[model samples]
Each structure stands twice: as C-alpha cells, then as structure tokens.
Target: MAAATAETPTDRMPILAAVCLAAVVLPLGFAGGAVATPAIGADLGGSPTAMGWITNAFMLTFGSSLMAAGALADQFGRKRLFMTGIAAFAALSLALSLAPTILVVDILRAGQGFAAAAALAGGTSALAQEFEGYARTRAFSLLGATFGVGLAFGPLLAGFLIASLGWRAIFLSGTIIGAIALLLAGKRMRESRDPHAVGLDWPGALAFTAMLTLFTYGVIEAPEVGWSHPIVAASLLGAAATLAVFIAVETRSARPMLDLTLFRYPLFIGVQVLPVATCYCYVVLLVLLPLRFIGVGGLSEIDAGLLLVALSAPMLVVPLIASQLVRWFSAGALSGAGLLLAAVGLFWLAHVDPAASGMAVILPMLLIGAGTGVPWGLMDGLSISVVPKERAGMATGIFSTTRVAGEGVALAIVNAILASLAEARLSTFVPQGGAEIRAAAQRLAMGDVHGAAAILPALPAAEIHNSYAVAFQHLSIVLVGITVVSALIVFALLRGDRASSPRAKSPDDTGFDSIKTGSAMS
Candidate 1:
C-alpha cells in the first residue's frame, strides 16, 4: 500500500506503458509467428513437422510455464521478474532473427515462450499493484485493447515484413519492442512481492507444466497420426495422470501456488470460464478462417489478410465500449449477450461462401469480434477483483494459463474435428477406405490444398476443396452450439452473486467486494 500511494499518476504512466508494450509484443509473436512460419520453412528448409514447431514450440512452452512464472513473481519480486523477462525476451528475439537453421529457430522460439510467460505474468501483476479500484479496471481495459491491436494487425504487418524485409524482420521487431519495455520498467516500476509467499511449490509446478506439455503435444500430433496411434495415446494418458498428481500435490501443500480452493468460489469459477468460451467462439477462427479463405476459396494471401482484418477489426473499439457499458449493465448479462451474438455470427459465417465477395463476410466477422470483445475487456479486471490483491500474480497467472492453454487445446480439437469430418466427406467422393484419403483430408483440413494434391495426385482439387468446405460448415455448426451453451452457463454463474467462503480474505484495500453483474465495476 505504501508503494502504491507513493506513485503519482506521472510515475504510473511509465509502468502502464511498459506493460502495454510487453502485451503488444506477445500477440505479435502469436499472430506474426504463424504468418512467418511459411517463409521460415522456405528459407531454412525443414520438414513439415519441424516447420510446425516454429509456432508450436513457442505456444507449448509459453502456456506450460505461466503458472510457475506467476508464483515466482509473487515470491521473488514482480518488478524483478518483469525486467528479467523483458531483457531475456529481447535477447532471444535477437538470436531468433539471426538463426541460421530451422532447428535453431524452433529452439529459440521455445526460449521466447518462457520469456513471454515471465514478462506477462510479472508485468500484469505489477499493474495490479500500481493501480487500484476503478483505475485498475481502466488500466486492464487498456491492456486488453493493446492485445487486440497486436492480434488485429499481426497478419498484415507480418505479411508486409516477410514480403519486403524478410521473415527475420518479424523477430527483429519483437526485439525492438522488448528492449523499449525493458528500459522503461527498469527505471520506474517499483518492486513488490507477497509477504506471505513461501518457498516454491516444486512438485505442483513440475506436474502442472508437464500436464500441459503432454496434452498439447498429444493434440498437435493427433491430427497427423490417428488418435489410436500409440504415441498420441501415451501422451494423452500421461497428461491425465500428471494432472491427477498436480491436483493431489496442490490440495496437500501448505502454500500451494495455485490455491485450488479458489475454484470453490463461484465468481472465481465464472471468471475462468470466460477465456475458454472466447477461445472456442473467437480465437479458433483466427487460425481456421484464414486457411478456409486461402486454400479452399482460392484467395491470395493479401485477400485473406484483408478478410482477417475485417474479422478482428472490432477488437479495436468494441472492448473499450464494453468497458464503459459496465456502468449500467451487469457484466454477466453483457458477457452472455455478447457470446450469443457471436454464436449468431458463427451461424452466418457457416452459410457464407468463403470465396464470395469480402462484403458477405465482413458483417459476420464484425459481429463475432464485437461480441467476444466484451468479455476480453472485463475478464482481466475481474480476475483480480475476485481475489485479494496480494494474490494478484497468482490470479493473473491462472487466468492467463486458462486463456493460452485453452486456446491451444481448442485449436487442436477443432483441427482434429475438421480433419475427421473431411476424411468422411472425402470417402464419399473417392469411394475408397484407405490411408490416402485420410492423409489428403488431413492436409485439406489444415488449408494445405497443394499438399493434399501432392498426396492424392488422382483426386481433383475441386473435389478436395468441396470436401473441406462441407467439413468446415459442420465445424461451424458445432462451434455455434458450444458458444450458446457456454453463454447460458456463464450467465447463470455470474448473475449478480458474491463469492462466499469462510477462508476467503476480507474485501481488498479498495473495499470492493466481488464484482457483480449490475454493479459499478469499482
């Protein structure tokens, strides 16, 4: 409290700027790395599997290390971890830009993920420390908006850089941003740590990271090798066992980093579900729709990027608007209504032809982005609101882990579903129950029409595209159903109720109780 009170608005501005800069770099890596992958493969000459790792390596490590980073921030120091992370991120980005081989790129990408986790977990927690009450809400809202800016422009920027400056420019860009954030935070941000924090929860940390790694690996591999494949089966089983071990360790630990009891609070549970719901309703489409437009619809990369802009554009303003709307509406009602609107957009997107004029898709994309933006803006602030401020690092960590890990899982599941559905549709057209059709379907589902053609030289490209289109339509319907169900559940869980528990801490320093649906956010 002394640290917070000591900082005037002028002092806090640099802290906010630093965290926002770090936030922007993260999504840039996410979206930009995906865009740069093809170019990296072309220049470095790697197998499809190795090429996939360029992105997968970053995601797996980033998602797995978040919880550990969060706990460490609380124990060690948020400002200390934040500065270290940004410095490491800058160093790694420089190394990635100079990487001579695809293997080097993959390894560096993994390192980048670890750095990202530290920067995000520490930076966000530091933000919670610097700003309180309504100001905290506004700061987090700006953070969300900054993330949207990265996601919204990542593709277009990456595409331009790849075409004009080479793929290395993408990593170089990250380096520049990271260096700036590092300098700003190093000079101004004050260090803070939980006085009650104990020694690291080593067993729980190991188990949780292992669980995420195994599950993500299994999901990524499942689409390529059949689910029945021994490797995929082993990985998934191992993940489940590790998860059980993690739960046991946390429940028994004297100072568990995760605090599993938080799950007992309905408000806490509701806050967590928001990200997973958005992953399915909005995040997956960021990957899938581009594949549909370029591979199945025969659009150029430029055209595909434009459509993606349409899809993500609403994120720019919609989230800020949703923040203001909290003044009059229950966040629960707003969140539920937003998801329903996104579901409607998904339904419309399902029926629209991917190759059709851009206008046909623009309206639906806007609807989906605008709808999903509401929860995105609120979820960050709500994450801390439900817990004591001293535990802000842990709360931010849990929310972020759920968001990033949930995205990886969701993308893997949807990709698997699309591949399976395509396989079924391809069988009807090819009339052969063989490995060739299965292989071709997997490629088609991933938006690699040329690759599918290579495998099935006899099959017509039109038939392949047609099969993929039908599969995508089916997948969209499935997403629609899930979003609707998630909306109802979220509304029910979040509708104007305070979390109650004998062990729960008293109201935070701001004296605000758990955020309710219809109350002022402060």
Candidate 2:
C-alpha cells in the first residue's frame, strides 16, 4: 500500500513537476474552454443559455467545492485525492470528446470542474507538505508560472486544435496532460493528511455551495428572464440568505472549513481584493473577447486565438518585472498601481473599433495583461504570508477559493450585464419589434450570429454587430470604474504591507518568504 515516503532533495523536483503539470490543466481548461465555445456552439447548435452553461457549469462547480476539497485533502490523504482527481479528470476529458449533445457536454463539464478542484486542492496541499522554507517558496513560485504558461498559450493551442481537428480536440488535449501528470506523480509523491483535522464541515460546505449555485443561477438567468422575474429574484434572494447562513455556520463551527477569523486581518482582506480585481480586469475578458472576436467580429478560430496571445503573452514577463519592482514598492502600492494601469487599458479598449486591425487593440490588451501581472506575481506568496505557519493550508484554500469563486461570480455578472446592455441597444435599433428583437439581442450578445439572424430574420447583420460593439464598450467603461474603486480599497487595506527578503528565515524555517512572480496567464 502507498504510504508517506521520506523526501530527499532528489524527490522534490519530480513532485513539483507533477503538481505543476496538474496546475496547468485548470487554466488550460478555463481559457481553452472559452476559446472553444464558438466552435462547440456552432457544431452543437444549442440555445444561448445552454451554450453559456458550457463554461458556467464548469466554473460554478469548480469554484464552490474548492474549500471542501481542501478540507477533504486534509481529512483523507492528499495523494489519494490527487490521484483520484487526476485519473477522473482524464477520463472525463475523454468522455467529453465523445459527448453527443450539448446537455451531455454541460453535465460532463460539471464533473470536470469537481475533478479539477480535487486535483488542485490535493496536489497543492501535498506540495506544501513536501518542501520547506525557501524551497517551498520557489516551488510555489514555479507552480504559479506554470499556470501562466497554460493561460498564455491555452487559447492559441485550443484554436489550433479546433481549426485543425475539431472542438473535441480541446478535451483530448486535457486528457493527454492529465495522463502525463498522473504517471509522473503516481510513484514519487507521498501521502499526507492533517493529524489534527476533525470531521468535514458539512453544514458550512452545503451552505457555501448553495449560495454560489443560487447566485450564479440568478445572474445567468437574469438576462434571459429579466432581473425582476420571480425566478431570478428568488434565486438572488436565496443566495443572500444562504450567504448569511454560511457565515453563521463558519463562525460557530468547532472546526470550520473556512476560518471566518481570517477576515479580521486587514492584510488578508487586501490579499483577497487582488484576485477579485483581476477577475474583473483580466479573467472575464478571456471569455468575452473570444466571443467578440470569433462570433461577432467573424474572425476564424485560429485568428481569434492569435489575438488572445497578444492579450495573454505579457503575463510571461511582466510578473517577473513586478516581483523585482516590489523590492522598492510595497505590494499594495504595486497592486493598486497595476489595477489603475489596467483601468487605462480598459478605457482605451472601449473606443477601439471591432473592424479595425488587430494591431489597433494589441497595446491595450498588453497594458491590461502587464498591469494585472504585478499583483498576480505577488499574490501566491502574500496568500500564505498573512497567516501563521500552521495555517498555511487554510490560507491557501481561502485564497484559491476567493480567486476562483470570484471568477465564476464575476463572469456571471458581466455576462448578464453585457446581454442586458445589448438588448437595450437593439431596442433602439429595431423600435417596432418586441419579443423577437429582445431574443435576437440576447443571442447577438453571446456572439451567436446565426441564431440571432434566425430569431429575427429581418434584422441586418451589421446592426447586430453594431449593437454588440456598443454594449461591449459600455461594459468596458463599467469595468473601468469597478477596477479603479477596487484599487483604492486594496491600497488602503494593505497600506502597511511589505514582503520579507527572499532569504529571510521564519521561526520554524517553514514559513512563507518573499519571491518573484513569473509569466502572466489567463
């Protein structure tokens, strides 16, 4: 039977490689899934709501279960969960390729999200167990870089696959990566669990999952049914009530899955802001732009992928630059400044014509990427730094949960807002038609040109495109305001924050130390 294995210097690299490979699957699935959306929709011919769930289902499950997965990793065994997760992830990817209907694909994508949570939570926890002090910092630093690699290249690779093979090739690619990671880690990694861990926080877990589900469902359905629809209103209200319950459960639990006390620290609040800020400033664009470029703008999958490369490539180098810049500037200052720069990019992007050459928008994409990279570089280290050494796992779990849950929530909100705005614009364009025009507007917002055209046979394609462009520009301006506000809040919360020298030793020699960030990713 597999048991805890003694680690020497030789064992560390293989373990790191294994987990890093596992890390790549998350962003690759995320960015690649978005990039592949148009192809998937074109082939399957699903409604706008169904196609939206193609990405939403995955993110929703992945985000909601993360803290529970982390708790399970500590209660069971990290290696056991890691292997189970990776093996299932690969199998699901293969299944996805064979899925016959969009509904089946959406169901399988939900499974993929759950598997991703297990693999990431287990593998990351295992990594923390395997390394010490500076070595641990370096290992995580490299892991963050691996995520960047996946984000930077996932769209391009997915585009190539969809163009050369089919949309199914995207899932095939995931299977291959999962298989390799499984083989590498199966024999080398050690089993680990927290001896002090108690029973799983079932109430807290249930409450949290319900809250996210309700909130995401409300947001996704709002644009379709109208925000005031009874179903949407009920879902949003339920989410808020569930959230209150979750907080209460966590606060009272003997051993909560999410430790509520962490919020007492201003630095912790500041760290959480970084991810939410980027979620708006950067991550949401990964989905929206691909839809705009491929679906609305009529660019081929391959060309859209190339455009995404420009948006993501700066992540590769700007993070390293941010890491070094932190030597002179506080992380708070750098992060706030970065968000401000991203705001500038968003403002610039709002004015660019969709029909213009790709070169016209490349600079703004680069600026947004480069700006967000600063906080992305420092975020991992700061996540654990705010807590004591023994709580490292908890800190990591909270940070990751915040980052991913924020992504799912933010994506839902932005998508709803964009669709609503498009509907409003389309109303002015086609003043006479009512329900038909509204339906077409929703489809157009999602880049479903054929569907929109079918819904409103008389509408001009140029008008559909123009409506989406104006809505997108309005959304960008809203995002700019949100980002600028978040920057000021982050700056204030982290006013006195500073990173220790990379060589600085902790009391236990196992605490987090300063580190440089590397490449940017999705």
- The C-alpha RMSD of each candidate to the native structure, in angstroms, is 2.2, 3.7
**Residue lDDT tens for model 2, 1-522:** 124444587877788888989888889999999988878887887877898898899999998988898888887888888899999999999999998999999999999989998898888888877775556655666777778778889999999999899999999889999999998889799988777778679999999999999999999988887888999999999999999999999999999999877676676788889999999999999998888887777788878888988778877777766666655666688889999999999999999976554778789999999888878876876676665544445666778899988999999999988888888888897788677776786787687766778876677877877887898899999999999999999888876423422234444434322332211110
Q: Total clashing residue pairs per candidate?
A: 1, 4
- Any idea what lDDT model 1 has? 0.81
Tens digits of per-residue lDDT for model 1, 1-522: 214532588989999999999999998888777767656766998755576677778877887788888888999999989998988998999999899999999999999989999999999999998886778888988999999888888777877787778989989999999999988898889989988777678999899889988887887777677789999999999999999999999999998868898888766777788899999999888777766676667665556666788777778898888888877777778889999999999999888875665678888888899899888887887777766778888889889988887877787778778888988898897787577887787777667778788887788877877777788889999999999998998898776454343134445533223334324353
Poorest lDDT segment (10 consecutive residues) of candidate 2 = 513-522
Which residue runs does candidate 2 get wrong by more than 4 Å? 1-8, 496-522
Clashing pairs in 2: 315-519, 315-520, 316-519, 316-520
Pairs of residues clashing in candidate 1 = 330-517
Worst 10 residues of 1 by lDDT: 509-518
